[model samples]
Target: MKETLADDLNLLSAFCGVRDLTDLSQNALYQKYQLKKADAFVLFGGSILSGIDVLITAMNNQVATNYLIVGGQGHTTNALRLKINQFYPQIPTKNASEAQMFNAILQLKTGKTADYLEEKSTNSGNNITNLLQLLETHELKKDGLILCQDATMQRRMAATCSKFAPNTTIINYASYKVKVMEKDNQLHFDRKLLGMWEMDQYITLLLGEISRLQNTPSGYGPAGKNFIAPVFIPQDVLAAFYRVAKLFPNKVRTANPAYAKSLEN
Candidate 1:
Protein backbone atom coordinates (compact mmCIF):
# COMPACT_ATOMS: atom_id res chain seq x y z
CA MET A 1 0.00 0.00 0.00
CA LYS A 2 1.22 3.49 -0.76
CA GLU A 3 1.26 6.07 2.01
CA THR A 4 0.12 9.59 1.16
CA LEU A 5 1.40 12.96 2.37
CA ALA A 6 -1.65 13.14 4.62
CA ASP A 7 -0.44 10.04 6.47
CA ASP A 8 2.95 11.60 7.11
CA LEU A 9 1.51 14.90 8.27
CA ASN A 10 -0.93 13.15 10.56
CA LEU A 11 1.78 11.02 12.10
CA LEU A 12 4.28 13.82 12.50
CA SER A 13 1.67 16.05 14.09
CA ALA A 14 0.74 13.32 16.52
CA PHE A 15 4.35 12.65 17.43
CA CYS A 16 5.18 16.34 17.90
CA GLY A 17 2.64 16.64 20.78
CA VAL A 18 2.28 20.36 20.25
CA ARG A 19 -0.30 21.68 22.70
CA ASP A 20 -3.16 23.85 21.50
CA LEU A 21 -3.19 26.64 24.05
CA THR A 22 -6.15 28.35 22.42
CA ASP A 23 -8.57 26.81 24.89
CA LEU A 24 -7.27 29.01 27.68
CA SER A 25 -9.49 32.03 28.09
CA GLN A 26 -7.95 35.30 26.97
CA ASN A 27 -8.38 37.60 29.95
CA ALA A 28 -8.04 35.87 33.31
CA LEU A 29 -7.55 32.23 32.40
CA TYR A 30 -4.66 33.14 30.13
CA GLN A 31 -2.69 36.33 30.45
CA LYS A 32 0.71 37.03 29.04
CA TYR A 33 3.45 36.51 31.56
CA GLN A 34 4.64 39.95 32.56
CA LEU A 35 8.11 40.47 31.12
CA LYS A 36 8.93 42.81 33.98
CA LYS A 37 8.60 39.99 36.51
CA ALA A 38 10.53 37.48 34.44
CA ASP A 39 14.08 36.70 35.42
CA ALA A 40 15.07 36.07 31.81
CA PHE A 41 14.03 34.65 28.47
CA VAL A 42 15.02 31.02 28.95
CA LEU A 43 16.32 29.51 25.70
CA PHE A 44 16.60 25.73 25.57
CA GLY A 45 19.35 25.25 23.05
CA GLY A 46 19.42 22.57 20.37
CA SER A 47 20.06 22.21 16.62
CA ILE A 48 16.76 23.98 15.81
CA LEU A 49 17.72 27.39 14.38
CA SER A 50 14.07 28.54 14.26
CA GLY A 51 13.89 28.19 18.01
CA ILE A 52 16.96 30.39 18.33
CA ASP A 53 15.38 32.87 15.97
CA VAL A 54 12.31 33.09 18.17
CA LEU A 55 14.57 33.54 21.20
CA ILE A 56 16.53 36.28 19.49
CA THR A 57 13.39 38.02 18.31
CA ALA A 58 11.99 37.86 21.82
CA MET A 59 15.20 39.33 23.18
CA ASN A 60 15.31 42.05 20.56
CA ASN A 61 11.66 42.86 21.21
CA GLN A 62 12.43 43.15 24.93
CA VAL A 63 10.11 40.31 25.84
CA ALA A 64 12.48 39.82 28.71
CA THR A 65 15.26 42.04 29.97
CA ASN A 66 17.75 39.16 30.36
CA TYR A 67 18.45 35.80 28.73
CA LEU A 68 19.64 32.35 29.71
CA ILE A 69 20.89 30.05 26.93
CA VAL A 70 21.21 26.49 28.18
CA GLY A 71 22.52 23.35 26.50
CA GLY A 72 25.55 21.06 26.36
CA GLN A 73 26.82 18.50 23.85
CA GLY A 74 24.07 16.25 22.50
CA HIS A 75 22.81 14.99 19.16
CA THR A 76 21.46 18.43 18.25
CA THR A 77 24.62 20.13 19.43
CA ASN A 78 26.74 17.71 17.40
CA ALA A 79 24.75 18.47 14.24
CA LEU A 80 24.95 22.21 14.95
CA ARG A 81 28.70 21.86 15.44
CA LEU A 82 29.03 20.54 11.92
CA LYS A 83 27.09 23.51 10.55
CA ILE A 84 29.14 25.94 12.65
CA ASN A 85 32.46 24.42 11.54
CA GLN A 86 31.41 24.56 7.90
CA PHE A 87 31.89 28.35 8.10
CA TYR A 88 34.33 28.66 11.02
CA PRO A 89 36.55 25.62 10.76
CA GLN A 90 38.83 26.95 13.48
CA ILE A 91 36.24 26.29 16.19
CA PRO A 92 36.71 22.71 17.33
CA THR A 93 33.56 20.56 17.31
CA LYS A 94 34.76 18.29 20.09
CA ASN A 95 33.15 19.02 23.46
CA ALA A 96 31.18 21.84 21.87
CA SER A 97 27.99 23.01 23.62
CA GLU A 98 24.85 24.42 22.07
CA ALA A 99 25.30 27.61 24.05
CA GLN A 100 28.83 28.04 22.67
CA MET A 101 27.65 27.54 19.09
CA PHE A 102 24.60 29.77 19.60
CA ASN A 103 26.81 32.41 21.20
CA ALA A 104 28.99 32.39 18.12
CA ILE A 105 25.97 32.65 15.85
CA LEU A 106 24.51 35.43 17.98
CA GLN A 107 27.79 37.32 17.86
CA LEU A 108 27.91 36.87 14.13
CA LYS A 109 24.33 38.09 13.85
CA THR A 110 24.27 40.90 16.43
CA GLY A 111 27.83 41.33 17.76
CA LYS A 112 26.95 40.11 21.23
CA THR A 113 26.48 37.07 23.50
CA ALA A 114 24.01 35.85 26.12
CA ASP A 115 23.62 37.29 29.60
CA TYR A 116 24.08 33.77 31.04
CA LEU A 117 25.14 30.47 29.50
CA GLU A 118 25.14 26.95 30.95
CA GLU A 119 27.04 24.39 28.90
CA LYS A 120 26.68 21.09 30.75
CA SER A 121 23.17 19.87 29.92
CA THR A 122 22.84 17.12 27.33
CA ASN A 123 19.07 16.49 27.37
CA SER A 124 15.81 18.21 28.39
CA GLY A 125 16.21 16.74 31.88
CA ASN A 126 19.75 18.00 32.15
CA ASN A 127 18.67 21.27 30.57
CA ILE A 128 16.44 22.06 33.52
CA THR A 129 18.68 20.45 36.14
CA ASN A 130 21.79 22.37 35.10
CA LEU A 131 19.79 25.57 34.67
CA LEU A 132 18.37 25.39 38.20
CA GLN A 133 21.86 24.97 39.57
CA LEU A 134 23.13 27.85 37.47
CA LEU A 135 20.29 30.13 38.60
CA GLU A 136 20.86 29.28 42.26
CA THR A 137 24.63 29.59 42.11
CA HIS A 138 24.32 32.91 40.32
CA GLU A 139 21.78 34.09 42.93
CA LEU A 140 19.06 34.60 40.30
CA LYS A 141 15.45 34.93 41.36
CA LYS A 142 12.59 32.61 40.34
CA ASP A 143 9.97 35.21 39.64
CA GLY A 144 9.08 34.31 36.04
CA LEU A 145 10.62 33.21 32.71
CA ILE A 146 9.70 32.70 29.06
CA LEU A 147 10.73 29.18 28.02
CA CYS A 148 11.59 28.75 24.37
CA GLN A 149 12.46 25.57 22.47
CA ASP A 150 11.56 23.59 19.36
CA ALA A 151 7.79 23.87 18.79
CA THR A 152 7.57 20.09 18.83
CA MET A 153 8.96 20.11 22.33
CA GLN A 154 6.67 22.68 23.97
CA ARG A 155 4.77 20.08 26.02
CA ARG A 156 7.87 18.32 27.26
CA MET A 157 9.51 21.63 28.11
CA ALA A 158 6.52 22.63 30.19
CA ALA A 159 6.47 19.28 31.94
CA THR A 160 10.18 19.40 32.78
CA CYS A 161 10.03 23.00 33.97
CA SER A 162 6.98 22.35 36.12
CA LYS A 163 8.55 19.35 37.80
CA PHE A 164 11.96 20.94 38.40
CA ALA A 165 11.06 24.56 38.98
CA PRO A 166 7.53 24.67 40.32
CA ASN A 167 8.07 28.06 41.86
CA THR A 168 9.14 29.71 38.60
CA THR A 169 6.29 30.79 36.33
CA ILE A 170 7.28 29.59 32.85
CA ILE A 171 5.80 31.20 29.75
CA ASN A 172 6.42 28.94 26.78
CA TYR A 173 7.33 30.63 23.47
CA ALA A 174 8.07 27.91 20.93
CA SER A 175 9.58 27.99 17.45
CA TYR A 176 7.05 28.55 14.67
CA LYS A 177 7.00 26.20 11.67
CA VAL A 178 4.64 24.74 9.15
CA LYS A 179 3.93 21.00 9.20
CA VAL A 180 6.40 18.63 7.57
CA MET A 181 5.15 17.37 4.22
CA GLU A 182 5.85 13.92 2.80
CA LYS A 183 6.33 13.37 -0.91
CA ASP A 184 7.16 9.84 -2.06
CA ASN A 185 8.02 8.91 1.54
CA GLN A 186 10.39 11.84 2.15
CA LEU A 187 9.66 14.57 4.70
CA HIS A 188 10.49 18.20 3.95
CA PHE A 189 9.65 21.47 5.63
CA ASP A 190 7.54 23.70 3.37
CA ARG A 191 9.51 26.77 4.41
CA LYS A 192 13.23 26.35 5.12
CA LEU A 193 15.02 23.69 7.11
CA LEU A 194 15.25 24.94 10.68
CA GLY A 195 18.63 23.55 11.64
CA MET A 196 21.11 20.85 10.62
CA TRP A 197 18.61 17.97 10.52
CA GLU A 198 17.63 16.47 7.21
CA MET A 199 14.17 15.15 6.34
CA ASP A 200 14.87 11.69 7.68
CA GLN A 201 16.62 13.17 10.68
CA TYR A 202 13.56 15.25 11.48
CA ILE A 203 11.36 12.19 11.17
CA THR A 204 13.59 10.23 13.52
CA LEU A 205 13.72 13.05 16.09
CA LEU A 206 9.96 13.46 16.04
CA LEU A 207 9.38 9.72 16.43
CA GLY A 208 11.78 9.78 19.37
CA GLU A 209 9.59 12.44 20.95
CA ILE A 210 6.49 10.28 20.43
CA SER A 211 8.20 7.37 22.09
CA ARG A 212 8.98 9.56 25.07
CA LEU A 213 5.36 10.71 25.18
CA GLN A 214 4.01 7.20 25.70
CA ASN A 215 2.65 6.71 29.22
CA THR A 216 4.89 3.80 29.95
CA PRO A 217 7.29 3.44 32.85
CA SER A 218 10.30 3.22 30.56
CA GLY A 219 9.38 6.45 28.74
CA TYR A 220 10.32 9.95 29.89
CA GLY A 221 8.29 12.56 31.85
CA PRO A 222 5.20 12.02 33.95
CA ALA A 223 4.35 9.07 31.72
CA GLY A 224 7.64 7.39 32.61
CA LYS A 225 10.36 7.97 35.19
CA ASN A 226 13.16 9.02 32.86
CA PHE A 227 11.97 12.67 32.71
CA ILE A 228 9.09 14.83 33.80
CA ALA A 229 6.78 15.35 30.76
CA PRO A 230 3.32 15.74 32.23
CA VAL A 231 1.51 16.40 28.98
CA PHE A 232 -1.39 14.14 28.08
CA ILE A 233 -1.63 12.28 24.77
CA PRO A 234 -5.08 11.80 23.39
CA GLN A 235 -6.22 8.48 21.91
CA ASP A 236 -6.49 9.77 18.34
CA VAL A 237 -2.84 10.84 18.40
CA LEU A 238 -1.78 7.41 19.62
CA ALA A 239 -3.73 5.84 16.77
CA ALA A 240 -1.93 8.11 14.31
CA PHE A 241 1.43 7.04 15.76
CA TYR A 242 0.63 3.37 15.23
CA ARG A 243 -0.46 4.09 11.68
CA VAL A 244 2.80 5.84 10.87
CA ALA A 245 4.84 3.19 12.66
CA LYS A 246 3.29 0.64 10.37
CA LEU A 247 4.45 2.70 7.41
CA PHE A 248 8.07 3.25 8.54
CA PRO A 249 9.14 0.28 10.61
CA ASN A 250 12.86 0.93 10.22
CA LYS A 251 12.61 4.51 11.39
CA VAL A 252 10.38 3.57 14.30
CA ARG A 253 12.84 0.85 15.17
CA THR A 254 15.82 3.20 15.15
CA ALA A 255 14.32 6.31 16.74
CA ASN A 256 12.25 4.56 19.36
CA PRO A 257 13.41 1.09 20.19
CA ALA A 258 11.18 0.92 23.24
CA TYR A 259 8.05 1.89 21.37
CA ALA A 260 9.03 -0.42 18.55
CA LYS A 261 9.19 -3.28 20.99
CA SER A 262 5.77 -2.36 22.28
CA LEU A 263 4.41 -2.36 18.76
CA GLU A 264 5.87 -5.76 18.14
CA ASN A 265 4.21 -7.09 21.26
Candidate 2:
Protein backbone atom coordinates (compact mmCIF):
# COMPACT_ATOMS: atom_id res chain seq x y z
CA MET A 1 0.00 0.00 0.00
CA LYS A 2 1.13 3.54 -0.80
CA GLU A 3 2.04 5.59 2.25
CA THR A 4 0.61 9.06 2.86
CA LEU A 5 2.85 12.10 3.36
CA ALA A 6 1.89 12.25 7.00
CA ASP A 7 2.56 8.56 7.35
CA ASP A 8 5.97 8.87 5.78
CA LEU A 9 6.72 11.95 7.84
CA ASN A 10 5.55 10.13 10.95
CA LEU A 11 7.85 7.23 10.20
CA LEU A 12 10.74 9.58 9.64
CA SER A 13 9.91 11.48 12.80
CA ALA A 14 9.97 8.26 14.77
CA PHE A 15 13.30 7.23 13.32
CA CYS A 16 14.76 10.69 13.99
CA GLY A 17 13.80 12.66 17.07
CA VAL A 18 13.50 16.45 17.40
CA ARG A 19 15.74 18.02 14.76
CA ASP A 20 16.59 21.48 13.37
CA LEU A 21 15.07 20.59 9.91
CA THR A 22 17.66 22.55 7.95
CA ASP A 23 20.04 19.57 8.12
CA LEU A 24 18.01 17.60 5.56
CA SER A 25 18.32 20.26 2.87
CA GLN A 26 21.95 20.99 3.62
CA ASN A 27 22.91 17.34 3.31
CA ALA A 28 21.68 17.28 -0.29
CA LEU A 29 23.90 20.20 -1.13
CA TYR A 30 26.81 18.51 0.66
CA GLN A 31 26.38 15.41 -1.49
CA LYS A 32 26.42 17.40 -4.71
CA TYR A 33 29.94 18.76 -4.18
CA GLN A 34 31.62 15.48 -3.21
CA LEU A 35 34.77 17.19 -1.94
CA LYS A 36 37.08 14.14 -1.74
CA LYS A 37 40.09 16.05 -3.09
CA ALA A 38 39.36 19.69 -2.85
CA ASP A 39 41.56 22.74 -3.20
CA ALA A 40 40.97 24.06 0.33
CA PHE A 41 39.44 23.12 3.68
CA VAL A 42 37.76 25.30 6.32
CA LEU A 43 38.00 23.82 9.79
CA PHE A 44 36.01 25.20 12.76
CA GLY A 45 37.03 24.68 16.35
CA GLY A 46 34.91 24.32 19.51
CA SER A 47 37.91 24.89 21.77
CA ILE A 48 41.51 25.53 20.85
CA LEU A 49 42.96 22.43 22.48
CA SER A 50 40.35 19.93 21.27
CA GLY A 51 40.13 21.53 17.80
CA ILE A 52 43.87 21.43 17.13
CA ASP A 53 44.18 17.65 17.14
CA VAL A 54 41.62 17.31 14.33
CA LEU A 55 43.31 20.10 12.39
CA ILE A 56 46.73 18.48 12.61
CA THR A 57 45.32 15.16 11.54
CA ALA A 58 43.62 16.78 8.53
CA MET A 59 46.82 18.59 7.58
CA ASN A 60 48.81 15.39 7.79
CA ASN A 61 46.40 13.64 5.44
CA GLN A 62 47.40 15.97 2.57
CA VAL A 63 43.90 15.72 1.12
CA ALA A 64 43.21 19.33 0.32
CA THR A 65 45.32 22.01 -1.34
CA ASN A 66 45.40 24.18 1.79
CA TYR A 67 43.78 24.62 5.21
CA LEU A 68 41.77 27.36 6.89
CA ILE A 69 41.61 27.26 10.66
CA VAL A 70 38.86 29.22 12.45
CA GLY A 71 39.94 29.98 15.97
CA GLY A 72 38.82 31.80 19.12
CA GLN A 73 40.33 34.84 20.79
CA GLY A 74 43.22 35.15 23.27
CA HIS A 75 45.90 32.48 23.75
CA THR A 76 43.87 29.62 22.28
CA THR A 77 45.04 30.12 18.72
CA ASN A 78 48.62 30.68 19.78
CA ALA A 79 48.58 27.58 21.96
CA LEU A 80 47.14 25.53 19.10
CA ARG A 81 49.74 26.80 16.68
CA LEU A 82 52.48 25.91 19.13
CA LYS A 83 51.04 22.46 19.57
CA ILE A 84 50.91 21.90 15.81
CA ASN A 85 54.52 23.01 15.35
CA GLN A 86 55.67 20.80 18.20
CA PHE A 87 53.90 17.80 16.79
CA TYR A 88 54.64 18.36 13.10
CA PRO A 89 57.92 20.20 13.10
CA GLN A 90 58.49 19.45 9.44
CA ILE A 91 55.28 21.17 8.35
CA PRO A 92 55.88 24.89 7.97
CA THR A 93 53.56 27.20 9.91
CA LYS A 94 52.59 30.85 10.39
CA ASN A 95 50.14 32.95 12.38
CA ALA A 96 47.80 34.60 9.86
CA SER A 97 44.33 34.21 11.33
CA GLU A 98 43.78 37.96 11.08
CA ALA A 99 45.04 38.27 7.54
CA GLN A 100 42.53 39.63 5.04
CA MET A 101 43.16 37.28 2.17
CA PHE A 102 44.10 33.61 2.05
CA ASN A 103 47.58 33.40 3.56
CA ALA A 104 48.76 32.30 0.13
CA ILE A 105 52.13 33.99 0.32
CA LEU A 106 53.06 32.45 3.68
CA GLN A 107 51.77 29.06 2.57
CA LEU A 108 54.00 29.20 -0.52
CA LYS A 109 56.97 30.23 1.58
CA THR A 110 56.56 27.13 3.77
CA GLY A 111 56.91 24.92 0.65
CA LYS A 112 53.66 23.17 1.65
CA THR A 113 50.14 23.90 0.49
CA ALA A 114 48.50 27.19 1.47
CA ASP A 115 46.88 27.60 4.92
CA TYR A 116 44.79 30.49 6.26
CA LEU A 117 43.34 31.30 9.66
CA GLU A 118 40.38 33.35 10.84
CA GLU A 119 41.00 34.31 14.45
CA LYS A 120 37.94 36.44 15.16
CA SER A 121 35.20 33.81 15.38
CA THR A 122 34.03 32.55 18.80
CA ASN A 123 31.47 30.01 17.53
CA SER A 124 30.30 28.07 14.46
CA GLY A 125 28.12 30.84 12.99
CA ASN A 126 30.91 33.37 12.92
CA ASN A 127 33.29 30.77 11.56
CA ILE A 128 31.14 30.14 8.47
CA THR A 129 30.49 33.84 7.91
CA ASN A 130 34.17 34.71 8.12
CA LEU A 131 35.14 31.74 5.98
CA LEU A 132 32.65 32.80 3.29
CA GLN A 133 34.05 36.32 3.24
CA LEU A 134 37.58 34.97 2.99
CA LEU A 135 36.56 32.65 0.17
CA GLU A 136 34.84 35.45 -1.71
CA THR A 137 37.86 37.68 -1.31
CA HIS A 138 40.03 34.94 -2.78
CA GLU A 139 37.59 34.12 -5.65
CA LEU A 140 36.99 30.60 -4.34
CA LYS A 141 33.85 28.51 -4.51
CA LYS A 142 32.06 25.65 -2.70
CA ASP A 143 33.90 22.84 -4.48
CA GLY A 144 36.89 23.07 -2.14
CA LEU A 145 35.44 23.87 1.29
CA ILE A 146 35.75 21.00 3.76
CA LEU A 147 34.55 21.53 7.34
CA CYS A 148 36.45 20.12 10.32
CA GLN A 149 35.42 20.47 13.93
CA ASP A 150 34.99 18.47 17.13
CA ALA A 151 32.55 15.59 16.65
CA THR A 152 30.14 17.13 19.12
CA MET A 153 29.93 20.43 17.23
CA GLN A 154 30.06 19.20 13.64
CA ARG A 155 26.28 19.14 13.10
CA ARG A 156 25.66 22.70 14.24
CA MET A 157 28.70 23.88 12.33
CA ALA A 158 27.47 22.17 9.19
CA ALA A 159 23.99 23.68 9.61
CA THR A 160 25.41 27.17 9.99
CA CYS A 161 27.61 26.67 6.97
CA SER A 162 24.67 25.46 4.91
CA LYS A 163 22.64 28.53 5.78
CA PHE A 164 25.48 31.00 5.13
CA ALA A 165 27.17 29.34 2.21
CA PRO A 166 24.55 27.20 0.52
CA ASN A 167 26.66 26.45 -2.52
CA THR A 168 29.83 25.84 -0.54
CA THR A 169 30.58 22.17 0.09
CA ILE A 170 31.46 21.03 3.61
CA ILE A 171 32.91 17.65 4.55
CA ASN A 172 32.94 16.70 8.22
CA TYR A 173 36.16 15.07 9.48
CA ALA A 174 35.40 14.91 13.21
CA SER A 175 35.27 11.51 14.87
CA TYR A 176 32.07 10.63 16.74
CA LYS A 177 33.71 8.75 19.59
CA VAL A 178 33.05 9.80 23.19
CA LYS A 179 35.60 8.42 25.62
CA VAL A 180 34.68 8.01 29.29
CA MET A 181 37.45 8.08 31.82
CA GLU A 182 37.65 6.81 35.39
CA LYS A 183 38.15 10.33 36.62
CA ASP A 184 34.69 11.19 35.29
CA ASN A 185 32.99 8.81 37.70
CA GLN A 186 31.06 10.55 40.47
CA LEU A 187 28.44 9.75 43.11
CA HIS A 188 25.06 11.38 43.56
CA PHE A 189 23.99 11.46 47.16
CA ASP A 190 20.35 12.48 46.70
CA ARG A 191 19.32 10.40 43.67
CA LYS A 192 22.07 7.80 43.23
CA LEU A 193 22.68 8.98 39.68
CA LEU A 194 26.30 8.47 38.69
CA GLY A 195 27.49 11.64 37.01
CA MET A 196 26.57 14.50 34.69
CA TRP A 197 27.82 12.53 31.68
CA GLU A 198 24.29 11.29 30.89
CA MET A 199 23.37 14.91 30.18
CA ASP A 200 26.05 15.03 27.52
CA GLN A 201 24.58 12.01 25.75
CA TYR A 202 21.15 13.65 25.58
CA ILE A 203 22.72 16.83 24.27
CA THR A 204 24.60 14.82 21.67
CA LEU A 205 21.42 13.09 20.57
CA LEU A 206 19.57 16.38 20.37
CA LEU A 207 22.33 17.93 18.33
CA GLY A 208 22.40 14.93 16.01
CA GLU A 209 18.64 15.15 15.57
CA ILE A 210 18.87 18.84 14.87
CA SER A 211 21.58 18.18 12.32
CA ARG A 212 19.54 15.50 10.58
CA LEU A 213 16.41 17.67 10.52
CA GLN A 214 18.28 20.65 9.15
CA ASN A 215 19.25 18.61 6.10
CA THR A 216 15.64 18.26 4.92
CA PRO A 217 14.00 20.93 2.76
CA SER A 218 10.88 20.95 4.90
CA GLY A 219 13.11 21.37 7.94
CA TYR A 220 13.80 24.93 6.75
CA GLY A 221 10.15 25.82 6.51
CA PRO A 222 8.38 28.36 8.70
CA ALA A 223 8.58 27.45 12.38
CA GLY A 224 5.01 28.57 13.04
CA LYS A 225 3.42 26.55 10.27
CA ASN A 226 4.92 23.04 10.06
CA PHE A 227 7.88 23.30 12.36
CA ILE A 228 7.14 20.19 14.39
CA ALA A 229 4.22 17.86 13.89
CA PRO A 230 3.57 15.35 16.61
CA VAL A 231 4.23 11.89 15.29
CA PHE A 232 4.69 10.23 18.67
CA ILE A 233 2.72 12.16 21.22
CA PRO A 234 3.85 10.09 24.16
CA GLN A 235 7.53 10.61 23.47
CA ASP A 236 6.99 14.28 22.75
CA VAL A 237 5.06 14.71 25.95
CA LEU A 238 7.71 12.87 27.89
CA ALA A 239 10.44 15.12 26.52
CA ALA A 240 8.47 18.15 27.56
CA PHE A 241 7.91 16.67 31.00
CA TYR A 242 11.62 16.05 31.42
CA ARG A 243 12.45 19.61 30.42
CA VAL A 244 10.07 21.07 32.98
CA ALA A 245 11.14 18.54 35.58
CA LYS A 246 14.73 19.63 35.14
CA LEU A 247 13.79 23.23 35.91
CA PHE A 248 11.43 22.49 38.81
CA PRO A 249 12.46 19.25 40.39
CA ASN A 250 10.59 19.80 43.64
CA LYS A 251 7.42 20.97 41.93
CA VAL A 252 7.53 18.09 39.46
CA ARG A 253 7.95 15.64 42.35
CA THR A 254 4.81 16.98 44.03
CA ALA A 255 2.87 17.28 40.75
CA ASN A 256 3.53 13.99 38.93
CA PRO A 257 4.71 10.94 40.82
CA ALA A 258 5.08 8.68 37.75
CA TYR A 259 7.06 11.28 35.77
CA ALA A 260 9.28 12.10 38.74
CA LYS A 261 9.94 8.44 39.33
CA SER A 262 10.73 7.86 35.67
CA LEU A 263 13.12 10.79 35.54
CA GLU A 264 14.73 9.95 38.87
CA ASN A 265 15.18 6.27 38.24
Candidate achieving the largest lDDT = 1
Instruction: Give the C-alpha lDDT of model 2.
Output: 0.43
What is the alpha-carbon lDDT for the whole of candidate 1? 0.64
**TM-scores of the models, in the given order?**
0.80, 0.47
Top candidate on TM-score is 1
lDDT of 2 by residue, 157-199 (tens): 6656666666655565542223222223531112222111243
Residues 177-224 of candidate 1: C-alpha lDDT, one tens digit per residue: 456665676666667754545766666666666767666875675646
The local lDDT score (0 to 100) that residue 201 gets in candidate 2 is 36
lDDT (Cα, 0-100) at 81 in candidate 1: 74
Residue 78, model 1: lDDT of 63
What RMSD does model 2 have?
13.8
Compared with the true structure, all predictions reach lDDT values of 0.64, 0.43
